[model samples]
Target: MTRTARSRALGSRPARSRTARQHAVGLAALLLLVAAAPASASATPSPASSPARHLEGTLPSGAAYMIDTPDHWNGTVLLFSHGYRPEGSPNPAVNAPDEPTKQLLLKEGYALVGSSYATTGWSVEQAVPDQLAALDAFTKEVGAARRTLAWGQSLGGLITTTIAERYPGRIDGSLSMCGLVHGGVANWNSTLDATFALRTLLAPGAGDADVRLTGFKDAADAAASAKRLGETLGTAQNSADGRARIALAAALHAIPGWNDPRTPRPAPDDYPAQQANQYTAVRGLVAQPGFAWRAEAERRAGGNMSWNTGVDYSAMLARSSQYKEVKALYKSAGLSLRDDLRALARAPRVSAEPRAVRYMADHAAPSGRLDKPQLTIHTTGDALVPVRTESAYRQAVAEAGRSPLLRQAYTENAGHCTFSPGEQLAAVHTIDHRLTSGSWGDTSPSALNSRAQQADPTTEARYTTFRPGPYPRPFRGQGLFG
Candidate 1:
């Protein structure tokens, strides 16, 4: 999720459940592979007919790992990577996308494993190593499997791809769901555009020259920043002009106009409704790591990495899916859109430190140089890690001449990581098919939808054909400017 970083990505539960589940997946990884996660210690048990052995331990890296193996051994394994967990988050363990999927996987005899990274949010640098350590632990503790298949959600999704690209021999295939496939550098840089616009246009302390964006002093400082931005959103939502400006900020990052999975999608041409949804996306940023994760990445990278030194707001907006929404709202509010763009042009620009910029590319960016098959799935309306990120990855893969190895699918759902038990199983089966056949079978919506229905007839399957828009900012290929 780097934060669709998924509210469950395609489906989220209540706020409490979502956070708990997200953290749960991050906590488990070492040893023999499996696809069944039991969630927290107190979570309800899965009803697998085959008895399963559960194991938990801490790796040398201080990361926690968990595993569940069915009594009947399946030669193949499912190594799961989890989403982002804020530092100090409680309970690190494996959490399947949903409960039914866990039971189903175990019933079919797939072993599941995952690891909590060495650190929380933006811990991509440590994710792969931690997982591998967990794999070694699993091998020592449980024994080796004939084959391994990797799958992940949110930030873990990116880790899964990196595994496919950098260490393809370790696994046969990859499944990334609700992933920030564009990579962390691009993720933060584009987010900065929206944050910068919100700060300059609507922050209560807009005129204050000393407010900090990065280089957080501590968790308290990050919390304060989140609180301030949240207040800005709350106050801004009260006025038409304020809401219009909010659209400008959210659109800059291509935040989807559909905010809640619980609600039906807004009409395609309903500018006002879409703008309102964009407000939810912009506001949702405040609920993330309170910008502390940015600090985490900054520290690891050696300095500040995200910036807006030479961005052209007009050009940026023109590329956004919400361009018409912003124009319509601004015009309706009697605000001059060009003037606002000019104002952004004049605002103090943040510049990336060279060391950090280099770190961003080497550590955070994905080379897209794949040596194995990878399938990426996303919700079309995920605002957190917008669907456009898939577009960015598609470009990267094409550029790397590995486009044929990558297959991207989508669910017509609204929230991040919102797939059902059926949908998740369908994806797993799809990857398994490729591994067994040495080719990606038809990945079209019709084929996938039918597969999902067969996987879980009880759950609604909404897979569909889609092409996400271009990512607003890409740091991998672009040099300093991105």
Candidate 2:
């Protein structure tokens, strides 16, 4: 079972009232540190007298990163961390000290140091140290500020928050965008995803290795299954190596029988066949048969696949090995089919054995109670990192009576980093206000995600008339990003 983009889903806006205004003001006050940045530091030589040079290096663990220094830089510095991908050469496009943030900060007189943490297959324990080391190296090499600000997006956000918590005094403040704060289940929404992948692969539409391999136990039968797979996957959808996809599909099929080798559960109701068709179709189009999947398939065929080898290797050898291997792994991980699927929803948590968890918990505190100012901006219709996540954290902070330091801004239309110029400007304004005034005070409902708001007529009609179809131009009312 797979999900398609829902045609009708409403966006939720922040509660409108004077209190929202007060929250905005509070955020402004918290970030006021940036406003007074110039006054606190001593006068420095001009950047013209000195040109900032970019430096690159690798950590002891082989994680690579880079740092840059502006001429005659003041003490202020910012450390940049990217999400997911391994850090290598700096990509100035998205990296800070790149175009946008760099130009703004430089004009305002702040030194910037960008870094790439240890890349994929490496956890934050390795990454954070590499980042800190980069900062130290930048300071000594370029002669900049003793303290620095940490910033990241998505996975980068998680690392940024963890770094902020772990090195409180050493870090000035953290700027996290769409970061994952809640660990375990919240971080890994994959169990259901795995189930869906299995279902799609096994469905009657096309090549299904699981079914091909199931009946045959002998080597001849295994060879037959592989031959059948080669024939079925020759189509564009299943073509290329797609080893991970194959592994995921195989895991889904094998997991069910491992727990109840005899009994089988029915498919889920939510993933209607039409939705599944749409998902497979769209995904097939978007992730064409060449790059990531093809390479994965080639790697698997070569007996050298990375990124969750457990799932891949097991699937590749499913016909040869007994079911015991997968069963043992799942049982150890508490993912037996005998349990309710919802119970399996709790992902690999901190309590899960250390060997199984990916990233190390740098600072595992119950959410910290911060006295400093903080502003959180999120799109109500975020498809990638749902806005509900931010709301949960805000609610937790409120329940703990530590809401004083928090300011929240909700945009109706944006999703993840997707935002219209108007929405982006608003976000920039919010950040600017926080940095300048040390407080924020704006909390009026604004049309951001038009599609999302249109899902609810009452909300949509209140703002403006709703016309549905491909997004109409110069989009106005209830939507920000097209």
**Mind sharing the TM-score for model 2?**
0.48
Residue 341 Cα positional deviation in candidate 2, in Å, after optimal superposition: 10
Top candidate when judged by lDDT against the true structure: 1
Worst 10-residue lDDT window for candidate 2 reads 471-480
Highest-TM-score candidate: 1
TM-score of 1: 0.86
Error of 2 at 19 (Å): 71
lDDT for model 1: 0.79
List TM-score per model, in order: 0.86, 0.48
Give the residue spans of candidate 1 off by over 4 A. 1-51, 203-210
User: What local lDDT does model 1 show for residue 213?
Assistant: 74
* Cα lDDT computed for each candidate against the true fold: 0.79, 0.41
